[model samples]
Target chain A: MIVTVTPNPSVDEIYWVDRLKIGKETQEEYLTRATDSDISAGGKGINISIFLARMGLENIAMGFVGGYTGHVVVRALRDEGVTTNFVWMGSGETRINLTVLEHGREHIPILIDGPGIAVAEGEMNRFMRRYRRMLKVADWVVLAGSLPPQVNLAFYYELAKLAKQAGVKVAISAGASCLTHCLPAAPNIVKPDTREHLSFEWMKLGTKEEIISAGKRIVQDGVEIMIVSHEVTGDIVITRDSIWEINARVQTTQFRNLVGADDALLGGVIYQIYNGAGIEQALRFGLAAGIVSAESREKVCRDMGKIEREMANVTLNRI
Target chain B: MKVGEIMTRDVTSVEKDIPVKELIFILDSAKMSNMPVVDEEGKLIAFISEKDIIKAALPGYFEMLHSTSFIPDMNQFAKKLGQIADDPVERHMHSDVICVEVDDDDLQAADLIIRKNLKSLPVIDAERRLVGVVKRIDLLHHLL
Candidate 1:
């Protein structure tokens, strides 16, 4: 079974509108009705758990949740057949994230930040106890998303160390200090979340060569697989034995929503690797799943046949 | 109310290739009379119920008609079950399953359940994926 941890979960609300008006100078009331809207559980690990469960994989989701929004997250995960083991906070509610998609301009979505959460000492201890127990039966553990407020930057590092000691493979998808601090544990797979930044550990990822060098640096530090986004349509995968570049033959115009595509890619790769696929084949399937998610109206595509059909459009070249 | 509003979203389903023994265990443990059979993409393709298992264990209609004096004993049922225990549930499941969609009226689901004598109806989406299940008990409880 797979175990996933999301430090801070959210209730993601997405609205689709024909057009959005901004910076109006006239003193008039304007109303923009949404064409459609949807709400679901949101967080990096939560998204991965949903994706894995859709594929009929047995996975348990662990995190901190509270209030009405927390119940929404648990219900959403339960509906998808994901076992949730969330620690309820004592004082605050889970945050809500909003995404606005405009017609004919879905390539660029408007994302709104949600409120941050502060984890108390008791809550942190409770989560750690549950996490350690889950690792005993988990074949793989994924630590993803940003750290909550008042949480240490090395939290992922501590979790990764515990997982490694239990002989569970670790896959981390995080950004900034949270990503860099876990390097000492030598996670099996690392996919640096590059949505907020285009560099890794002070190294720029502006070109293919630069990405390859940065990825190799991480692999040299004992990470089995290191994936870095090179562009919107391509990614670079580096390992101890070889380096490969994967590209999806998809147009920007075909994208309907790109919010959860990255999470799907990581989930897809882990799913394949857990099922005994080679690294090259796993990366190819991951890219196909990512492309399918990007082209769908849903945040993450749950159709396995659609992903299989799109695999022909993904190409992998050894660098 | 729409089917989506009142349906039980946490559905327990199995794939097409599960063994009959495992299927029976799941049904007994979950206390469910029937279970939907989905494909790899989670689309509802068939359904299997406790009635189907009993039918499989019983003698054929022609055989029973041939010998009206013959009564089905535990030995007969056990032998029949043993023959198919290792077989996949797909061999005996009903491929033409009756289902409702999420946006359908709850009255429509009630009509189907009462008319068809079903314990529950699988609720699907536009893509025919199994999203939830609407049970007859749930419909009656909603009335109160």
Candidate 2:
């Protein structure tokens, strides 16, 4: 079974409007009706858990939740058949992130930051105890997403270390210091979260060569697989023996929603790997799943036939 | 209204193998009087409640009847609690659980709760996976 840890889970509220206009200088009251709307449990690891569950995989999502928003997150996951093991914080509610998508400009989404969470020491201890117990039965443990405020920067490092000791494969998807501190644990898979920035530590990920070099450095540092995003439609996968570039043939205009596409890609790869697929095949399937998710209205596409068809559009080349 | 519309979606559940001590802690922390027990695949299998814990701690009906002047004491309750704290919840959970499907009419859940004197009814999907729960209060609120 796979176990996903989302330190700061959120209830994502997405609205698709015909047009969105921000009034900067003029002060006027304007109303815009949403053509479509949806709310779901979100956070990198939570999305991965939902994606895996959609494929009929046994996975558990662990995190901290509180108040009414937290209840929404749990309820949504339960409805999707994702088992959850969340620690209810003593104070404060779980954050809610809002995304506004304009009808014609679906590629450019307006993202809103959610409230930061402050996890108490007691809550951290409770989460650790539950996490340790879950590690015993987990074959793969994904420590993803950003750290909550007041949480130690080495939180993922500690979790990866524990999972390693339990003989479970660890996959880390994080950014900034959270990712930097956990590299020592040598997680099996490392996908640098590039939403906030395009750099991993000192290495700039502006060009293909830079991304490939950075990926190789990470792989040499003990990560079995390092997947670095080279562009919106491509990723560089570097292992000890091989380096491959995975490219999706689909155009940006074909994407209806790119909110959870990255998570879907990671989830697809993990699912394939868990089912005994080789890294190349897994990456191919993963890219296909990501393309399917991006082109559909759903955050993560679960249609196996569609993903299989999309696989024909994914091309992998040795770097 | 459909049961899915009125049911409480945020229902807390547990597996059958959960320790009684952990079960009690969940019950107390969640402020839930009862919890549905599901299998690994999320199939509803049994139900455990505060009443069941109390029944386990107290003397049985036969024992009470046999002794005319039997009195319950803290020591007896404590000893019984200790004995069962580490035991799996399946030993005390009621296997015959009354439930409603998510697509069923809300009145069906209300009827079951009222007729069975139950606090809530576990709502399941077509595949019998525990999805949500319909409580006595939820029905009453929907009535208004």
Choose the strongest candidate by TM-score.
2
Q: Would you list the C-alpha lDDT of every candidate in the order shown?
A: 0.85, 0.85
Task: Give the interface RMSD of candidate 1.
Answer: 11.3
* Candidate 2 local lDDT, residue B64: 48
In angstroms, how far off is A158's CA in candidate 1? 0.4
* DockQ list for all candidates: 0.04, 0.09
Docking quality tier of model 2? incorrect
Residues A1-319, model 2: lDDT tens digits? 7999999999998899998877684479778899999888999999999999888896778898887888888878877877677877776889988899997787788888586479989678767776776776689999998888999899999999999998999999888557878889999998888787767677777788887888788888889998876777889999999999999887888888888889999999999999999998899989888889988888899898898899999999997
Q: Is the docking of candidate 1 incorrect, acceptable, medium or high quality?
A: incorrect
Model 2 bad stretches (over 4 Å)? A23-26, B1-31, B34-144
Candidate 1 root-mean-square deviation in Å: 14.9
Tell me how far the alpha carbon of residue B63 in candidate 2 is from the true structure, in angstroms, after superposition. 15
The digit string of per-residue lDDT tens for model 2 on B65-135 reads: 66645665567778888999999999999999999999999878888999999998999889787767888
User: Can you list the residue pairs that collide in candidate 1?
Assistant: none
Poorly placed runs, candidate 1 (over 4 Å): A24-29, B1-144
**Candidate 2 clashing pairs, residues 3+ apart or interchain:** none
| Residue A138 miss distance in model 2 (angstroms) | 0.6
